[model samples]
Target chain A: MEKKIRVLVAKPGLDGHDRGAKIVARALRDAGMEVIYTGLHQTAEMVVETAIQEDVDVVGLSLLSGAHMTLFVDVARLIKKKGLDDVLIIGGGIIPEEDISKLHKEGIAGVFGPGTPCEDIIKFIKENVKR
Target chain B: MKDIAKKVLSGDSRAIARLITLAENNDPSANDSMKDIHPHTGKAHVIGITGVMGSGKSTLIYELTRLYRKQGKTVGIIAIDPTSPFSGGALLGDRVRMMELTMDEGVFIRSMGTRGMLGGLASAVYDVVEILDASGKDVVIVETVGVGQAEVDIIKIADTTLVIIVPGLGDSIQTLKAGVMEIADIYVVNKADRAGVEQTVAEVESLVDITCSEKERKTPILSTIAKHGEGVKELIIEIENHEKYLKKTKEFETKRRLRYEAELIEIIRKRLMNFIFDEEQFKDKVELLIDQISKKQIDPHSAAEEILSKILK
Candidate 1:
C-alpha cells in the first residue's frame, strides 16, 4: 500500500497567528497527506515528540515569531538526539534568506518563506521524504 | 512485540521512547508492539489539560507532575503545538514551560506538534496514551495547543479533560463559548489571583448551568493560580472525583469503546486509501483524471465516479 505521507505542522514559540498554518494544513490534506496541526505556542521538545508520536514523515515548523533561530535549531537538535534524522525537518514563515543556510546547516531540510505556494511544499515533501 | 513490550513494562525509558516514535511514525513494527502492549494498558489514568495561549497550562502540569512524583507515580505528558505552514518548520516552545519536569526521573514529557491536524492532537495520540499506560505510568497528561475548537479533540481520548482558563483577559469567557465549554470535564480558572477571578468563575458557572442537566454531574469549576501553585490540590481532587464518577457510571468503558471504534474506522479508511493509491493501474487512471480535470475536460465529480467504478471492478 502506498501510505499517505504524514506531516506534523507545528507553531513554536509565542506566535499566535495561525492563518498560514491552517491553510498549509488544508492544502496538505487536499494533497492526500495526513497532516496534524499542532496549535500555537509550542516548544521544540513538543514538536519533536509530536513528530515521533505521530510517526510523521515530515515535521514542518511555522515560525513568524522571530525566535525561529533558537526554536528551529532546538527542534532539529532534539530530533537528531532522538535519532529521527530520517524525518524531514522543514521550516516556513518570515525566515530571512541569510538564516536559511544556517537553518539547513542545523539539520532543517528546507525553508519556505512568504509567498511560497502550498504545492511547492507538498511536492518537496513528496520528493524528500525517505518513506 | 514480546521483547519491546517486556522492556516497556519493565520501565525501560529508551524502549518506551523508541516505541512511541515508531508508533507515531506508523512504522511497520508498531502494530505488533501495540498488540503486545494492549492488555497491559488501562491501568494508567489519562488526563488532558488544555487552554488558550498564555494560560500557564505547562506550569500547572509541571506542578501537578511533581505532586504525582512525590507520591512515587510515573507521569507522561504530551504537549501539542501548531506547525508553521510556509517554512515547514516548527518552534515547539512549550517544553520550555515544562523544563523542570524533563530531568525528573519519575516524569516523561513529550511535546507534540499539531502538525496541521485540526483537533489539537495527533492521530497517534491514542496509541501514545496506551503506550504510556502500558509502560507503568500511573498518570498520563495530554496537553493540547488550546486554540479553542481544536482542543475539543481531547474529549475523545482523555479519561478526564481539564479546561484551564485564566482570568484578566477581557473576553476570555466569551471565547469559551463553543467547542471548548462542551467538552470540559472540569474547568480550572487558573491565574485566579491575577484578577476578575470571581467574574470568571461566575461566568463559567452560568454557562455550565445552561449547558449541563441536573441529572448529569456538574462540571466542577475550580480556581487556581498555577504559577504560585495555589489551589492545585483542590483541582487534583476534582479530577479524581471526575474519574471516580466516570468509573461508577460505567462511562469509562463506553468512552474507551467509542475510542476503539473510532480507531478501527480511521485505520480501515487509511488502509483503503493506501490500497487505492497503490494500485498501478489506478494511479494511471488518477493521473489521467487529473489531466482531464486540469484541462477542464471532466468535472471532479465525474472523475471521482470513474475512479470509484474502476475500484469497484
Candidate 2:
C-alpha cells in the first residue's frame, strides 16, 4: 500500500474560528491524506504533542485570532524542539502579508491567508511533505 | 527492530508512534518488532467503545481515560474513523475531543482510518492494540467508528466492550435487534441527561432481561452524560467488575484463547492474500488466471485453487 500523507490541522490560541480549519481538513481528506484535527483553542504544547503522537507527515496550523506571530511560531518552535524535522509545517487563516516571511523563517513551509484556495494548500503539502 | 520494541517497552513516545505507523502502513519490517513485543502484550485491559455517530463515544472515552489517570493508570487510545472510499483518505477528528489528554505523558492517543476494512475498525487495529499493550498502558481503549447493527467486530478484540447509545435516536425496538445489542458487555446510555433518557434506559433494560435469560450473567445498563463527566466513575467500576467476572468465571483465559484464534486466522488470511496477489513470482500467473476467469474460461474457485496449489507446493 502507498503511504498516506498524514497532516495535523490545529487551531492554536484563543481562536474559535474553526470553519477555515475544518474546511482545510475536509480538503486534505478529499486530496487523499489522513488529517487529524485538534479543533480550536489548542496550546502549542498540545499541538506538538498531537503531532508527535500522530507521527504525521505534515502539520498545518490555522490561526485566525491575529495571534499568528506568537502562536504559529510557538507551535513551529515547539514542533522543531521536539525534533519532528521530517514533518512538513504549513499555516493558514487571517494573517497579514508581512508575517508570511517571518513564519517561513520560523519553519512554516507555507502560509495561506484568507481567500487562499484549499487546493493550493493541498498541493503544497503533497509537494513539500518531507515524509 | 528489536531495539524498537525495547524502546517501546520503556515507553519511548516516538518509537511507539513510529511502530504504530508502520503497523498501520503494513510495512514488512514491523513484523519482526511485533514478534518481539508479543510476549509483553495481554497485560492491559482492552476496552472497546462503539456507538452511532455523534453519540458521544469520544467524550465518553475522554472521561473514562481521565478517571483511569486519576487512579494512575496509563492509557493508550486508538480512535478509528472511516476512510473515504473515493479519496482513500480520512479525517481523524477524534483527537479534537481528546485534546486535554494530549500533553499528558501517561496518555498516548492515535487516530486511524479504516483503510477499506469494515467492522468499525482499521485493518491494523489488532496490531496497534498489541503495540500499545506492550508499551505499558494499563488501559487500552479502542473507540470504533460509529456503527450500526453489523459492526460487532469490537467484541473480537476487546476484553470488555461497551456499546454506547444516546436518547431520541430510536426507541425500545432498536435494542431488540440482533448483532450489536447482544455484543455489549455493558450498555452505556450516554447523554443521559437528555430528554427520553428514562425510556431509552427502560428499553435497554427490558432487552437485557429478555436476552440474557439464557446467559450466566445479565448485561448491565448504565446511564451517563459523558460531556459533563457524569456517571463516569460508576461506568469505570462496572468495567472493572466485568473484568473480574470474566476472571472469576475462568472466562478470561477462554476469551483470550478465542481471541488469539481469530487473530491467527486473520493473519493467515492476510498473508495468503498478499502472497497470492502481491508476490512477484506469481504475479503474472495470477493475472493470467484472472483473465481466464473473466473470459469464462475458468471459475474463481478454480483460480483460487490454482493459486493455493502453487502456495502449498
Q: In angstroms, give how far residue A107 of model 2 lies from its true place.
A: 1.0
Q: What would the per-residue lDDT of candidate 1 be over residues A1-101, giving only the tens digit for each residue?
A: 22456788889889998889888878886676667666777778877766654567899999898988999999999999988867999999999889999
For each candidate, give its TM-score against the true structure: 0.70, 0.95
Model 1 segments more than 4 A misplaced: A1-131, B168-176, B277-284, B287-291, B294-296
What is the fnat value (0 to 1) for candidate 2? 0.82
lDDT (0-100) at residue B234 of candidate 2? 95
Q: By how many angstroms RMSD does model 2 differ from the true structure? A: 1.9
- lDDT (Cα, tens digit) per residue for candidate 1, span B1-313: 4697789888766678667777655667878888998999898889988888888888899889877788788898887767555543444456556655644667776655554467777767888888888888899999888666555777778889888888766654584567876788888999887768898888888888777766579888999888788888888788889889999998999888877776776567655665677667677778888999999999999999988887688
**B232-298 in candidate 2: lDDT tens per residue?**
9999999999999999998898878877887887778777777777889999999999899999999
DockQ of each: 0.07, 0.81
Candidate 1, overall lDDT?
0.79
